[model samples]
Target: MSFDKIRDPRKIRHQIGDMECDYIYTAGVAGERFYIALRDEEKLLATRCEKCNITFMPPRLYCDNCFTELASFMEVPSKGVIESYTITYFDRDGQALPEPEILAFVKIDKTDGGLIHRIGEIKPESLKIGSKVTAVFEAKKERKGALTDIKYFKPA
Candidate 1:
């Protein structure tokens, strides 16, 4: 039986309901080490692909370009340049926030990849594409080996 041709909308049948399921997710080897460094040392880690000579922040286990195993890791500076940004007046739930938040994609120095994080400590009007920013980590006792370990990126 061939299912590719669908000419009539009335011929289609569907069910609409919530499908509930539970699952556990683990951050594999590369992610595990990356999060550990962020939580323990409040540092940024990047993986280098010797074959491609590319460094990826939020380190990966293999090179995206050549599929080479990325076994070399390096610590990159917590500072970066704002490559792009957005200002949102509402929260994720569509509720209005007291103040708009500025989110930006910060290109970490010396790495080919960057992280998307909230940009704080400045007004949205003052933000620019090339603005320098630094990661502001949560207090030592508050870190939990997650991206949230860095509360936000602030103007450097």
Candidate 2:
């Protein structure tokens, strides 16, 4: 039966058993390059759109403004200022965490965009909107091509 003609609720068929499915996700061209730099070189990469004169963190393949292909990739300083932040006392499951975790949206120097990551090495009371922070990466031996590769951002 075609779903296009369906009008009655009783005509719908339902399955109760769980469906098994598996999938893998790739970061795509621009993201792959970004991750590689972050993992292998411990560098923060940003893509610039010459047309719009805008730089994007977590680099993009194209510019959102001019729709120009972003061919220029550059390393942005790992240090940045906290534009905004929050302290979460509960975990993802809503359970109370032993210690509150600080998360911030940091505007990296010389870039139009920034990264949102956990802020560490400082008390929540001390954090401010303009606080200077730096990315703390995982040890070289433990580096991985993922956002988690950055342990957290700390006061610089």
Candidate 3:
């Protein structure tokens, strides 16, 4: 316990190991409903806050503006406009990807919020700001209750 008796503190033994975990998550009130719509109906849903008069994509349980509980769910259009974009050439591990991936912030028509998803079916250099795009969903039977249910957004 006394540092005075220690000669080389840096030489002390240290343990190294790997840890892994698995679990299920409840997507909360709004998210569960939104995801279910995508999986079962091939539709996108948003939460409209009555008090704040705002609609949120990938719906949240509460309004960011007025802090009101958002309960009304509405089907949002699959079509939107590209607000911004990027072509990523590297993966998360910093390795180069076989092909660059186009990603963008799509502003759904008439909605206050937008979804950030992959852009497909067009060259990266051809992608334009304010360009129209539509979500292409996976076949109904193949969809899991997740964002990937929509394979990608393509030119409308």
Pick the winner on TM-score between candidates 1 and 3. Answer: 1
lDDT of 1: 0.92
**lDDT comparing candidate 2 with the true structure:** 0.91
* Per-residue error (Å), model 1, residue 143: 0.4
Q: If scored against the real structure, what TM-score would every candidate get?
A: 0.87, 0.86, 0.86
RMSD of each: 5.5, 6.0, 4.5
Compare the candidates by lDDT and give the number of the best one. 1
CA lDDT scores, all candidates in order? 0.92, 0.91, 0.89
RMSD of 1: 5.5
Question: Can you tell me which runs of candidate 3 are displaced by over 4 Å?
Answer: 1-12
Among all windows of 10 consecutive residues in model 1, the one with the lowest summed lDDT is: 7-16
Pairs in clash, predicted candidate 1: none
Q: Candidate 1 residues 31-96, lDDT tens each?
A: 999999999998999999877989989899999899988887899999899999999999989999
Any residue pairs clashing in model 3, and if so which?
none
Model 3: how far is 122 from its true place, Å? Answer: 0.3
